[model samples]
Target: MAYDPNNIFAKILRGEVPSKKVHEDEHTLAFHDINPLTPSHILVIPKGPYVSFDDFSEKASDAEIAAFTRAIGKVARDHGLAGDGYRILANIGENAHQEVPHLHVHIFGGKRLGRMLPKE
Candidate 1:
């Protein structure tokens, strides 16, 4: 899918929309989810206009990739979720129910998250 410049994440990055920002750097922006599923839920997004993980991995510069990866780790550690662990999830496509067109990762922690999916 094509990246939408008007996507909510893009708006957040552009400061057109307000977000409870957690971390901001030259390459990324991390913030608290407005409707969190876990006790500690944060969304980390790249500053660029990438539609999905595939898009990002294929097109982002090495510096951007490194910065984004480090940003995720930093956000997790800053939130104190590193010890007990956390789940990092990025829904890629329509089948995965990716709500937004921009690439973003969800950090779920602050509790035992249980299984990632239902039993078969």
Candidate 2:
């Protein structure tokens, strides 16, 4: 399937839409998800738009990946999830329930999120 250029994440990346920013650098931006899955649910994304996880993993530089991982760690620690650990997720295509085309990392951890995800 073709990627949608007008996704909400694209707007957020363009600054046309507002987001609760948590961390940012030249290559990536981290922010709170408007519709959170948990108390500390956050989204970390690359500034450059990618159609899918495969595209991101294939084209992203080592530096960019490092920066993203570091940022995720920092955000988790800042949110007090270091001791308990947090879940970092990246949904792929529609089968994975990806609503936005842009590549994003979801950082979630707050209460005891059991082994399975919460019911929708």
lDDT of each: 0.95, 0.85
- Each prediction's TM-score against the native? 0.98, 0.88
lDDT of 1 by residue, 7-46 (tens): 8998988889999999999999999999999999999999
Worst 10 residues of 1 by lDDT: 1-10
Candidate 2, position 14, lDDT: 85
Would you give me the overall lDDT of model 2? 0.85
lDDT string, candidate 2, 67-102, tens digits: 877888889998999999889898888888987888
Poorest lDDT segment (10 consecutive residues) of candidate 2:
1-10
